[model samples]
Target: MDISGAGALVTGAASGIGAAVARRLAAEGAHVVVADMQEEKGRELAAEIGGVFVRVDVTETDQIGEAVAEATRTAPLRAVVNSAGIGGAQRTIGRDGTLGSAHDLAAFSRIIAINLIGTFDVVRQAATAMSTNEPDANGQRGAIVNMASVAAFDGQIGQAAYSASKGGVVGMTLPVARDLSASGIRLNTVAPGLIDTPIYGEGREAEEFKAQLGSHVLFPKRLGLPEELASVVLEFLRNDYLNAETVRVDGGIRMPPR
Candidate 1:
């Protein structure tokens, strides 16, 4: 799919990898819709990139639908990047082996809701909008890129909820691609490792954590940048043949059990 001059929606575009992807896509000439819950940051980024900001909470179906509508309102809906997600750390059982202190079901459900179901909802709605678009020369209407985590495959301790949520994303790739193939839309996923993002905190604490995590990385022995992840996302969106795939942008690091 040719991303230039198309309507692209990126969820969680307020910061981190999503923000980076939005900037890159805009640079590629796509009219980006920065959809995020952070009004101030989302609006700022959108303005910086000459794009529009749509305040959207991916878990809210109505908000996502509205966002999709706004994104496609002025141009053909061609690309969607599902980057909105939350992270949590909780063991299945507590140290005292008490059910009351174990992982909270509500927290687990929230993670799944935001990371897994929310991604699916965005894809479903975006694909629907893209289906109405006239197909390009390659019979492609649009492309979708979803965010997962290395935790999905190599989850450490205290990551049950996060891992399960991201695992759902990885599991859905093939089936979703097949389902959307007939509609001329493609689906894929990106599983990032320990990237240098705000989620890891700031200053000395973040540096220390990065060092510890970097030790596990096979080469370069350092954290990845958001731009690196965004580059992979661009590849997934540009390459028409790369469908139903989940690429890990982890710098060859398979997380160890904690």
Candidate 2:
């Protein structure tokens, strides 16, 4: 689990929690790969952190392979953070209850493809590469951290697609970790509550909206910061004893179904 002088890949590193995780890994002396779809921002962050940026769409196998290959070129790939995902909110049936009131099948499928299947693809490739790495004293070759959401547990109304996708991520953590155990690769998931990120638009109105959302937190009365989540991610990677666990970074908030 010693990532120093090794390489790390972080998907969705263009911004938000993924960006924070990428920077943290770089600061820890890992050759980080900023894998993301946003070329400009990904490149910018890569340059800022003295890492490489690979334009990757997790759903595409070729693109993910390229990113993993790039990460391991200079150093052994020891850390991977699967943070690339999208959000979709649609009920099985709209209030109208008309013929077309059902949730859009394509939208639901897209979320699953990206959040669930995409995550597994990256993990599989990353593990394959890590399996070739020389193990440490504890026979640990690498560590993986996957991003989930509190919605996976406390899904609200209209969050069918988003919740299902994240739920799948959480559901697979233990089994995937078991499968990777022999290779000395560990897998864990972080289920985050509301974290302040670019997904929320910038402006005074946006601040007000976020505040209303934060009011629900049990303490501190604010949304979590991306860095806060990033810190936990590092722990998961560095703590060799941690595996097959889903830790919630929420501030003691159990979301209410709206």
Candidate 3:
């Protein structure tokens, strides 16, 4: 799809990878819509990118639908980035081995609802809007980019719940892509390795951890920039052929067992 003049809805656009993708797409002429729970940050980002700010909590279907509807008022919907998610850590057994308790359920449910269900809600709602878009020469209606993480592949300790949710997301890629294929929509996910985003505190990795990652990664020793992830989304939307795949953006860093 030609990004120029295309309407785009990006969840989690207040900061990190989503913000970068929003800015990049807007720079390329897409009418970007920044949807996030952070009203202040979301509005600021929308202003910065000359995009619309539709405050949305992706976990709510009504909120997601409303945001998409608002965005479509400008241009025919063309693209969506499902970047809204949260990371959490929990243990199956506490230090006393009391078996998973209320805290465990809370952490797990929250993570799954926000990361897994949230993505699904955004995709389902936005896809409905995108299907209404006129197809391109290749019969392509639109594109959807979802954010997964390296933990889905190699989750460290204390990440059981988090990892499971992300794994569910990564696992759905092929099926979701194939399901949406008939609608002329492409679906894909990006599993980022340790990136230099604010998600990592101060972008610091333990020396031992750094050494371990260096042993596996092929290139780019340092953390990945948000722009690197955004670049992949841009191409995925532009190419018209890439589909139903989860491309790892990690620098070959398979997460270690914590």
- Estimate candidate 3's alpha-carbon lDDT, on a 0 to 1 scale: 0.86
Better of 1 and 2 by TM-score: 2
lDDT per residue for candidate 1 within 1-258, as digits (tens), equals: 799999999999999999999999999999999999999999999999999999998889999999999889879999999999999788899888789999999999999999999999999999999999999999999999999999999999999999999999999999999999999999999999988888888899889988988988998799999999999999999999999999999989989898
Candidate 2 structure quality by residue, lDDT tens digits, 143-214: 999999999999999899999999999999999999999999999999999999999999999999999999
- Per TM-score, the best of the predicted structures is 2
Order of candidate numbers by lDDT, starting with the best: 2, 1, 3
Overall lDDT per candidate, in order of appearance: 0.95, 0.96, 0.86
Error of 1 at 87 (Å): 0.5
Model 1: how far residue 68 lies from native, Å: 0.2
TM-score of each: 0.98, 0.99, 0.92
- What lDDT tens digits, residue by residue, belong to model 3 across residues 153-252? 9998888888888898899889988889989999998888776556544434655554554566667676678899999989888878789888998877
